[model samples]
Target: MIGMYDDVVLSFSESKAEEAGMARSMTAFGRCSDIVGGKSITVELKSVNNRFLDCNSRVPRAYGAVEERIKPYLQSRGVVRGKVDVFVSVIRIDGGETELALDGEYLRRYIELLRQMRDEYGLRDDISVMTVAANRDIFTETESGATEQDTEDIMSVISRAVDTFIAMRIAEGENICRDLCKKLEHLGALVGEIEREEPRMNEAYRARLEAKLRAVLEGRGAGAPDEARIITECAIFADKVAVDEETVRLRSHLDAFGAALSSDDAVGRRLDFLVQEIGREINTIGSKVSDVHMTDTVVEMKSELERIREQVQNLE
Candidate 1:
């Protein structure tokens, strides 16, 4: 597989989109820094492996929907094949506005409650300034919503941060692919060894049968035609536990696996299936190879295959 490391940046500037009143099109970007008119608003998108683009935004509730819009942006880049856990954060680098607000509905209701309480307890004052300020929704000051112009400016910044995040993930994917390929190569080598040993194994089985027949006939004069009996029993045992066809099919599957690994497409599911097939072949070998040495070798191959499977889980 070819490892790709890339970053894309698109910007929306207030001065650029002023006539439209809002940014006309969204931009997909990477790690961002926006410096405008001596003030800056920075947005960072940090993405990691996930089953999908499960995004979390660290901004005012008013701007939470921006995460949804980012979905198309990420998909457009062809980098959305795997799970991506994105954390979006917006920071006002140089603050331009500090907002204050009163919840009129909440304040009105508090006043009514104060009046009722004073009458019941015979208190002189019905309302206190401290109590009004302490009421959860009665009063507050904070950064407000993104204006049409603010969106135009902020989007430009966010796009840059996304670019940085994608670059990092691509690099990470590269490293993972490299390690995975090495494991695949090792597995291929082990399969090749089995193929080479198959002929030798057949010869060994014939030798074992002859030795067992002689041992039986040597013990008694009445042991007649033991050669014929041994040949029949040996044939039955060999047919019952033969691994020749298993090895051949497994070798073919290994070649197909190499093709899938090198393809520049969404092959995660395909590779997963191939791994299952490979596991099946190995299990068959373990069961058929009455030889202790062959069984031990199959066990070791399975261990390596398991490690390879784990690394493939993170592929895109």
Candidate 2:
């Protein structure tokens, strides 16, 4: 088994992920900080596996304009699919304060509803200001809107974090690729063993059948049976038990698995499809072959394939 961090090389404390391979099933944390408009801004990015891109952001209300921009930025940085959560926090160098406001319309509606209930159901009219204040939505905490310079500063920090994040995923992916390739090699060897045992199985079956027939004929005081009929029977039996088609398809599937692993795009689904096809071929070979040695080889191949499948699940 390849250790989780075996392929990653971390060079600095600021980067969550460094130079390495890629994997879809991974978690990475990234953080970056910089000065913008004489204020210190820090950005953090957290990524986890998902079938599609789902990006969310947490920033000061004033910088809400950047929330919609986070996903595109990540996508541009090679985040094709994942559940990525970004947090951007700004600290004014001079310790600036935030603004606040009340939603007067919402408050008025709440008060009117309370009064209506009090009149209709004979409820107490003691709805104090404190009671209404319990609805946090009555007040909004506002911050200064992010200027063009502030946006650039924030994106710069986030880009650095995204770079580290992608590096970690790639490192993990490389580890998975190495493990999967080994399993495939072992599987191919097992397939070769099965191929070797196939001819022996046919010969063994024919010899056993002929011996049984000869014994029955001799016990019945009969002469030697026709050789041609015996040959025909053996041929038919061999044809029925042949694994030519299965082996051919299995080999093709193995090649496809290799190609998928080497692809630059997201190959997780493709690899999964190939694994299923390979397993199917193995099962077919198991059912068609009767030799104990061949059965054992099939079992071994299945084991290797299952391991490969496990690793493929971690890829994208």
Candidate 3:
């Protein structure tokens, strides 16, 4: 089996490690060719990101059973989600006898059409056997029947191609994991910054409220504002701008996201859900905090989260 990397064993080992701790990207290509059972068998695999697993195969018409087996075989190898296309080609190398015959009806019609074109358009009269035979569809090949061994040989080639395909995915996935981890760290720091500024935000709101109330009372010639009423109004303002619950939930979601990144299981869908939850908490925090600095920080957090969401879609 041929692979992109020279050290297939080491590449496979690293792939398994990525499967255990990181994520697999759903885009890669692999091709393998080998001589088996006196036949040259080649298999190619290509995949792209998709919301679900969609497997398609293209093989010789005589080997329809090979197409049926490709999908389940891929799933067995942990290809949970992607649009995967497999191609298989086989050539006999043992000097086997084969029959080729011309399609009489198709050849007749093709010749008739060529003559008609020549007559109608007064075109060149250079059409000959070579020119006519250029249309390959005018001939047919009688292929030998497929046997159990043919299926086995083709499947073996497919397995090797998949090995290299998965290794490429794992390598790309590790890079994605590193980028995601950095973004998550930034998110955690932003959450901490929000928490640190929460108390100061409440105090600022309370002071503003008190000053507004005092101004209104003095304008009405009411001598000094009632201290008790001012305290009650400030308390209400503080409660209205409180984001302790939201920030706490946001922090928890960030932690869950970090844990999911290192999980052994398929975490694409799980990470998607966590991003949604995190967005909800960030929105809540945005609504509660009116400070200019806090608002800008929240916007930056949302921007980072959006990037994370886009990156998560590439994972499987």
Over 1-316, each residue of candidate 1 has an lDDT whose tens digit, in order, gives 2121122132433222212111111112245665753335666655444554455565543455565566676565545454444544444556546566777887998899889989988988836788778777776545565555655565566666655655554445555556666777788777777777766776677678777767777776664655677787777765766678888888787777766755655566677788899999999888767666676678888998999788766665
Root-mean-square deviation of each candidate, in angstroms? 9.5, 5.4, 6.2
Winner by TM-score? 3
Q: Rate the local accuracy (lDDT) of all candidates.
A: 0.62, 0.75, 0.83
- Prediction 1 TM-score vs. true: 0.67
lDDT of 2 by residue, 37-112 (tens): 7778888888776667788889877777677788987776556766888888887775666678888998999899
Least accurate 10 contiguous residues by lDDT in model 2: 12-21
Name the candidate that leads on lDDT. Answer: 3
**Lowest lDDT block of 10, candidate 1:** 18-27
Estimate the TM-score for candidate 2.
0.75
lDDT score for residue 188 of model 3:
83
Error of 1 at 80 (Å): 3.1
**What are the runs in model 3 whose C-alpha is more than 4 Å off?**
1-11, 14-21, 97-142
Query: Residue 276 CA error for candidate 2 (Å)?
Result: 1.4
Those runs of model 1 whose alpha carbons end farther than 4 Å from true positions after fitting are 1-30, 36-39, 81-85, 89-96, 100-145, 206-223, 226-233
Clashes of each: 15, 7, 0
lDDT of 3 by residue, 111-193 (tens): 99999999999999988999998999998664476688888888888888888888877777767777888788888889889
